[model samples]
Target: MSLLSVRSLTRSLAQRRLLAIDELCLADGESCVLTGENGSGKSTLLRILAGIDAPDGGTGCFDGRPFAWRPYPDWLRKQVTYVHQQPYLFHSSVIDNIAYGLRARGVPGAERERRVAEALSWARLNHLLDTPPARLSGGEKQRLALARAWVLRPRLLLLDEPTASLDADSRRQTIELLRTFADAGTTAVIACHDRDVIELAAMRRLDLVDGRIITD
Candidate 1:
């Protein structure tokens, strides 16, 4: 079954058209790459898909149900997670940052600790658990961001240029982690321009031009 579906999706910002997608669908365990030049609304579309922003027209569905617009559904929020190009880390220890989601969902002490530990290990940030996120290096920050997202095990993961600011090795490792998520049945939609990310994702490419999907 398709995990996500978008039809005639459109968006505008400050009276300027930002994105207009005719049709898009992502199946369970599939990854799709959204590519476009700067200011082409790649991030805008990602935001819309992640339910961070609402489109001007058209409809979207998650798991075959009409997606709620005003006040996003709790169930949908659990199913989809968006990781920004520059992750926003709270003013807290790395462990706290990784544990934020579980805490929000009311997952208490023991299980939360276990999930946080597993996520830190998976993102290779186990050693940095006590360190402050602000004191971490760029790559470490990225890993922490991934760890924050991973603990939830979201069904539809939306990433915005996840490897754009990483070094070669860090980028490779990030791609591998994303692949691992996809293999484990987490559908991913990544908006990126990195060649390595595109190649490694092995996704159907959708090219956007001036906010419209031009090729797929």
Candidate 2:
């Protein structure tokens, strides 16, 4: 069964229609790579699904429950996570940043610490646990953001241009991390043009054109 399903989704900017999708579905544990030209609405679609932006019109089902945009169903919020090209980080240490979501969700201290430690190792950030986010390199920061979300163990993850600004080595590291996530059964929809990401063994491709998914 699909974990997410949307129908007749649409979005506009002033009079310009930014996105229009007749339907889109993702199965549990699926990995999808979104491809399109710069203005083909890749990011816009990701933002809408992430609930960071609302669609002009649409209906969705997540985990067999109704989903919404304006209020962004509270239950869905706990099940989906989004990370941008330039992720926002706390002003504190790496460990603290990864623990923020857990703390907010009222996870017990012992369990929180355990998850944070696992996340640190997952992102290969264990050595930098005490370092502030500001001190990290671009790739490191992106890893931190992924780790932050990973610690929450959200059922779905939406990533927009996650490797857009990284060097080759960093990009490779990021891809490895994504592979780890996929291995752990975390569903993902990634917007990217990188051939390596597009060719990931676990990913199926979706191409957006003229504000619509032209290929799947």
Instruction: Choose the strongest candidate by TM-score.
Output: 2
- What are the lDDT figures for the candidates, one per model? 0.86, 0.91
What are the candidates' C-alpha RMSDs?
Answer: 1.2, 1.1
- Model 2 pairs in collision: none
Residue runs of model 1 more than 4 Å from their true location after superposition: none
TM-score of each: 0.95, 0.97
Candidate 2 is scored at a TM of 0.97
Q: What range of 10 consecutive residues in model 2 has the weakest lDDT sum?
A: 195-204
Question: Per-residue lDDT for 1-216 in model 1, tens only?
Answer: 888888998888898989888888888888889898999989998888777988888777888898755666778887888999989999989999989988989998999999998998899987877788998877788888888889999898899999987888888888878877877878888899988778866768889998998988
> Candidate 2: misplaced stretches above 4 Å?
none
lDDT of 2: 0.91
How many steric overlaps are in each model, in order? 0, 0
Per-residue lDDT of model 2, residues 1-216, tens digit only: 799999999999889989999999999999999999999999999999988899999999998998778888877888889999899998988888999989888999999999999999889998887688998999999999999999999899999998999999999999998888898898999999999888773458999996899999
